[model samples]
Target chain A: MKRHLLAVSTAALLAACASAPVVEHSKMTGAEIAQIDAVLKRDFRAKGQAKMTRLEPDAVQRECNLHADNPPDSVARSLQEAQLKTIKYPSDSLLGDWKNGRKIAESGRGMQWNEKPANPGGGGCYNCHQLSPQQTSHGTLGPSLKGFGKTRGYGPDMQRYAYGKIYNAKAYSACSHMPRFGHSGSLSEQQIKDLVAYLLDPKSPVNQ
Target chain B: MLVSGRSVLLTAALTLAAGSAAAQSQFEKYQKMVAEGSPVELFELVGEGLWKKPQGPKNASLEQCDLGLGAGVLQGAYARLPRYFRDVDRVMDLETRMLHCMMTLQGRSLEEATKRLFGNADKPSEMEYLSAYVAGQSRGHAMAPGQSHPREQAAYELGRKLYFYRTGLWDFSCASCHGEEGKRIRMSELPVLYKPEAARPLIATWPAYRVSNSTFKTMQWRINNCFRQMRTPEPVFGSEVVNAMNMFLTVTAQGEPYRGPGTKR
Candidate 1:
């Protein structure tokens, strides 16, 4: 394992050396980091609600960028463990308003630079996967989650998975197209519950 | 004293390093390729041949169908869809409207055609190819959805109301990301729909060929996705609400050119 890591780092180092200006530090130097920030600030205009801060990568993000999306196995496992620890399940049962779930899944609005600060957001799940039978429009970024509850069984374990997955997909698959709903504060607790009900409720069109 | 402190700090750092190495990589590659000329061109051919070819009960072709462009006119029709039809009156997006056309013109069962919309090129599942073909026809036309009819006007008004209507777990409305220009999440540009110029082109480009998924996606499919993002109740199939939303967006994009079997990231 150590040898493989060494090989990867070596390859990265070699690639870096061959590419352009030499990078001397394992970590970005203060000047280098500052320069990148300055460049972005100059180039990207801040619009309505969209701000320059969106470009800033947190520590975890920085780590992820350092490695390729498929970082070493140890790295994936560790990050997942850390992510899993952050999830907070509801004390009550997982069911909510499926009608609301329909609305949430169908909605593609939220968090725009021009969006009113008080208005909530949409999950934009349909942008990636198939969820309900009725709605024909949807994106293909993620897997079609139709028959989610029927196939998985809308039992306790699954309820947890749906809720948790909606909350933070990184906990399950370190690199899932499904958003980090809770982590990013994109969806609230009740909204997550409603999404769960949408997928798990037998009466919901998704299962039907 | 400085050297002693440095050694202790180094030891602590090494010890802690053993614990935090489990992070995954953030791929920048996916972001760079957005809107890099869609690969739907290949699917366009497959769809075109299927358009006039007949296999259903009526032994007819989709050539005489009206996709919101009067009858038998294929030019720039794909983009101004999901509007109100006088005979049908009710609003319908591309897939549902096509289902009506195939049922009436091609004599296929609604079940067969409806099921075909989401899947591959198997029997009774030609919507994918058909959509690709139809979408290909208006590849570069502007979004010129006409709202001359009263029903069309009504649908547009309803859709406008729906676009801003916030009712769901998250209280999300369509205007959240798309209402604003210059907003992108994780490298995906969220086009502003309030601006007709921006919304029209995108609306016109659906029934696009998604290369990564290798499937044809209708505008209804795109709206369904927006619903997913909104965390709201999934709309019913061929429901008026869906039509209403389409009319809303279509009218907003009234004068933009048409383009379809559009390539999406």
Candidate 2:
């Protein structure tokens, strides 16, 4: 019965495509993108923290949009270099308490329009990545960081990398789907440090 | 034709074999069980009552209201909607058309009609109940949203553009999650909306009863929530931008049977 349905659908799709005069393309032209942006600007209303400025694409975002998140090596390198300059590491420590970091990772409360601007927002790390083995409800969009410090040695370099990546993920990978938590002002330097510790501290559940 | 037929059979067999090998998780099995015995009928009954009830300032019911099927005609009306309406001189989805009725026929202000469009699990809105009832009426009908009209075509184009237009904090578009085939986010398989096969089943099941939230959802609410998560500003309800997106999805999945007010995770 399922096969029959599939065959019927396949035939119908072919027929529709053949008959329809519409020109469907995967890539959008510059003018089309601009038009869409205009339409969005007109249709969307800024409610609280969600201002119209959020629609404005940054340089990295523009490149990612143009290339469909698959920019050429040279383009990616240049963009990443520019993005890397945006990250501001703390003058002192790059690691903080992992316990606080665990709470930050679990909470997906930041940057939404409904959220209060005064309250400290969460890192929302667990939304996309599997951080600790005990959390069965974590998302799988990102790579698993279980036993992160155990697998990759708990060194200063690893700590720095984690802090930098959490601070500005696009700085490392030009078109990464992960949000620039620190760059976007969604996470503070201290919060990022805590996240770094959550990933790199041997005592942290992520490393355990 | 013969080769294509044989290939289809082979593909179906492989899909079945794969499906059996990777058995459904306990959670999915439970969801399926719950879905099989859903109480959506109660919502439909409530919706039917609302449809006939007279409570607006005009002291009239929605009986005379046209759903692009002439006045008071309900059969197979939803199947051919998101189409051009001459009275409004615009293309409208079901919710938009219903809103228009509330304003014109029922003598309600735009603010009053749209003041509480979305509802929670404790109390479903009139729109949710009405959508459930209306959509249920067209259950066996084929999905045939407007595409031939110039406005509809334009809406479809805009929706297509919006689908791939990536921007914002996460640098995500609808395509970011839904553009690819055979990809999933945290065990939930994302459907490639532009592709006909993947889009058909997804579109056929809308105004769905989401088990996760214990709430019935409309296509308008679905689009609004997506933008919210996309880190973009909130879209106005019954806006052209949303209608266009709905047109795109509906037209893409045209010809699939309407089997909704469906259950969802």
Candidate 3:
């Protein structure tokens, strides 16, 4: 009688599973997000330059996480406007030397746990976008910036746009994959200006 | 007129062929060549020795340790791992199970067992060696990770959540790289782990020897390193979070043959 009952219960359990409703994948629940945060907090420990605070998501990050990096257009515009206000452009100029800019873009160092805090961080531009045709090896995550200045007019307005974009990419596209180099304090104002020149300067190899 | 038309068609075909050839990256070709002649066998041999050697306080070998299968059964054991053991009352991955054996049977402390989970290129860690040996034993056996049990199901669900849960400084998750199909970073191809087709091949060949790093890396090392790159804090060794992620991946790749301790670029 016990064996028969066990068999009947197992069959019922199987039936329940077979007819179970599939969960929607459109968005994660608040409770689910909280659980994930709790798990991360429990598992991860601070090491080197990477602190526990890094786990906390900013407003933009939280929105991106909720929407899978595809937030509604109205929401994105407001968030982007707020982000744009954060950029602090220099009064003097928006362009720097293209020669130094090439070096900054080439290097993929700094901000890692092993890296020294004193050392200036690299822009790591080559890791996502192609700049100069001479550099054969480059990542293809972002659109190629080869012949950028020559194609898109090398004017003061263009330079300002480039500077702003490099400073905080979220200002233009709220959920863009590009890192906010200047906003995150990974790249300095001078460093961002240099990257703008690298993209917009007539003399740069990228323009060549 | 017919001869002229045929020549025109041939010329167009040649041009298309040349265009496609130029599109293929040279780095990808080199990576394929390196993978073909990888020295994973050497690591497997080293791992076998470490598994048999007894050097803890109690001086006990791991041969008596049960890996989901019965005691001393190396064959087909790895394929059915990340399972719920009644004794532990939790779902444990292969690495966690080994850590348990080392502490219980070998009489080693938690700190001593986990002190050097990740080793340098100069010398591989004990966990790496054991993982390579154990994973190798399951070669040709089907991947059948524990999913039927209640605890195992819970672990898998947690892992699934973690895969998509984007946080940290970079706002990256495992899904940032592995979620998309046919996407790549530079020359390296990223596998979509949630999907069965992509997950199967990748899960089968892990606990691999990375050619780029010149070191044997287990799944634990892989998870830890990924977190490092994601700009997150270091995960605790043998942590529940790490094991859950493993369970999720292994269960996603269920039914494919275990053919790993593989070579990677």
Candidate 4:
């Protein structure tokens, strides 16, 4: 095993060196990134609920984009800390009604230009997660949250973690594929709390 | 064509179903089933008629419209698309080229041509039918998009950046969903389109007939719809960004055999 590891490391080192030129050529310059952003702004038109503001990247987004979603550990830690400060946790219990949470998870509706701005958006959880055991057509993007409560224990700490994650996934993991539901104002505080309950409540189908 | 298609599908179906050990294989079976029942040829046939029929102010058929090979020559043309057109001085994919033909050859106003660009199942668009027919002709050719031209090179670069440039309410660049391998959204396995392994098969089979919506879709419409789901502003049809993005994917899948105008679930 030791010999095999050494061999693999040597091969990897050689491969990395060999591909250095290609990597250098592929890296986008700040000016080029700006130009691409300009092209997008010019080519795309604001329609319905999707305004031109959507094109503008936040600090976390700019950093993530610059680094191709893999910023340096120190940068990521600072950004994540900033993101964590954005979450508005409820004064009371983090958990809400699990039934409502199930509905939110199953729904893939929300925030699209075609959708109504007045209507509250669905969590779209099932779009990238496996929550309930009965839902077999679940996505495999994120780690499966099946039996989340049972495995992790339905405790206050777990509930708080779930709420914070749902509200702003970037707070926990910078550049996560999951959307910042609450931070983006796509989901209400109550809705995120409901999603937390859906994940952590003992009676929830996800736990079962 | 129908008889041969049915027989081929029936044989394939018989050979399948024995390998249902995994979910991926199961999804493959479902895809196969959808592909087998697709009425893609019907759309192609309609497109052929539209291509020949005269309608605009000039009452001229698109038979004389050049698709890079020359006027009216369609064989393997789709394979070489999103190419730099000297006349337009821009990189145009199949739909953009067709739009150019509509204005230049047919004498149709841009508004009139673009008004019904995307259509529903009950009523398909001119662009959709045209895409199916034009793309079908390139079945055996290798996917070789224009890369030599400075404009083409620039477009590809822009598209590469756009693919990873995350923004919008959801903060989804194309890479957010499609970057990682083995990731899925609601049972649909997202393809990492930048990589040749995924880009080849997908690029070869675009301008596909979708079974779910019962509609013939062009690459232009496909990109536009993706932006809608991405929670971004609508991409203007046949715009530079859309063509550039298409160029990027096509260039990535370069040298892969063109095998579609395919069926999609």
TM-score of predicted chain A against the true chain A, for each candidate: 0.78, 0.87, 0.86, 0.86
Cα lDDT tens digits, model 4, B29-79, are: 767777877889999999999999997999999999899999989988999
Candidate 4 TM-score over all chains jointly: 0.89
Candidate that would win on lDDT:
4
**lDDT tens digits, residue span A9-79, model 4:** 76455333321011111345677668877888899999999999988878888888778788889989999
lDDT of each residue in B134-215, candidate 2, tens digit only: 8888786677887778998898888877787777666778887786666555446678888778777887888888866778
* Each prediction's whole-model lDDT (CA): 0.63, 0.81, 0.80, 0.85
The true-versus-predicted C-alpha distance at residue B105 of model 3, in Å, is 1.2
In model 2, where do residues sit more than 4 Å from their true spots?
A1-25, B1-23
User: lDDT at A139 for candidate 4?
Assistant: 75
DockQ of each: 0.02, 0.34, 0.31, 0.33
Selected candidate, larger lDDT, 3 vs 4: 4
User: How should the candidates be ordered by DockQ, best one leading?
Assistant: 2, 4, 3, 1
After the best TM-score superposition of candidate 1, give how far the Cα of residue B261 lies from its true spot, in angstroms. 2.9
Candidate 2 DockQ, CA atoms: 0.34
Model 3, range B67-136, lDDT digits (tens) per residue? Answer: 9888889987898888999998998989999999999989999999999888878988999889989999
